[model samples]
Target: MAKSKLSEKEQVTEYIQKLDPSLAETITFLRQAILAIDGEISEHIKWNSPSFYYSGDMKPFNPKEYKRDILVMNLHRGTTILLVFPTGAKITDTSGLLEGNYPDGRKIAKIKDLDEAKSRQKDLENAIRNWMGQIEK
Candidate 1:
């Protein structure tokens, strides 16, 4: 298929395929695992990394609020993968997978490698679900 005709997820596939070999596998696993949680969740490249967001309808809000954005991967650090939740302060996550306190209402989930990502997959999904449930629809 032509690149312009590709779906957002197909674009996501292309983006993942070009990732650093070490990070690609783990990120791919995460992309699959996250998409499995809910059909409304979709991904695309944002901030130069794989970004997941809720495509379902919700009460309208300012775009700068980032209410629809579920998470964005922060791969700039290279060695570890950081899933940054823009409005994560709203979710009360007890799974311990999510940590960090930012005044900007962000929370981060850290995964160092594929093994750790697999082990923490459930917690990650739970955190995602927790965020989804709090959505204003």
Candidate 2:
């Protein structure tokens, strides 16, 4: 029998399922919330993890590289999950959810569990939207 292929979402879901269940659950919550931003927001596997993008068309980025990157942050070896804003150095964090100071205009938000992910949902959404706006400029 021919093998069926999994969609990008399914592939990412499957990949996360193999990690720590709590971390997987947290990531899943964030994924859904991120997708709810708008119709243009899309996701794909990047940096060997789920990456979200925002463009006029709902298209996923090439997995080979995070070209025109937006967000490329996730669980690092099941230790801690981070939401990276590769082009959001100037993005403000009024919610006090973002951390890390990289020189290359990158910022990250560390999400520990479903509760934390839930608490920071609004902030995450804001960051993503703001980041997308920045990229457009």
Candidate 3:
């Protein structure tokens, strides 16, 4: 069968569907919540994972700038899912949920499942919003 062209979100959803059930559920929840944050947020497959980009006034992401501004999820290791900020944007984390204290300013929020994701949803969205502002500048 010829593979039909799929929208980016569809492509990502397809990728998520292949994951272990628990991980898939967590990623799905995160994807929906992140997209709900802003209408301008767009996503695509980057580094073999679902990556989100904010295209406010700036030009949409080019291949060269793939790492410049992105919110990506890492699910390669195991049941634990990682929300990674590759560009090292300084995001607000009043809840102190984000880890990775690298000097480069990169950070990540580790999420285990739907419940944990729900608990940290507000913090994650706030951090993402702050990160978006950082990239806009």
Assess every candidate by TM-score: 0.94, 0.81, 0.85
Most lDDT-accurate candidate: 1
**Considering summed lDDT, which 10 consecutive residues are worst modelled in model 1?**
1-10
Cα RMSD (angstroms) for every candidate in the order listed: 1.6, 3.6, 2.6
Q: Please tell me which model should have the higher lDDT, number 2 or number 3.
A: 3
Those runs of model 1 whose alpha carbons end farther than 4 Å from true positions after fitting are 1-5
Question: Model 1, 33-104: lDDT tens per residue?
Answer: 999999999999899889999999999899999999999999899779999999998888888888888999
TM-score of 1: 0.94
Backbone clash tally for model 3?
0
In model 2, which residue pairs have backbone atoms overlapping below 3 Å? none
| Ten contiguous residues minimizing lDDT sum, candidate 3 | 59-68
What lDDT tens digits, residue by residue, belong to model 2 across residues 47-76? 788988764643455544333566875667
- Pairs in clash, predicted candidate 1: none
lDDT of 2 at 13: 82
lDDT of 1: 0.93
Q: Using lDDT, rank the candidates from best to worst.
A: 1, 3, 2
Q: Quote model 3's TM-score.
A: 0.85
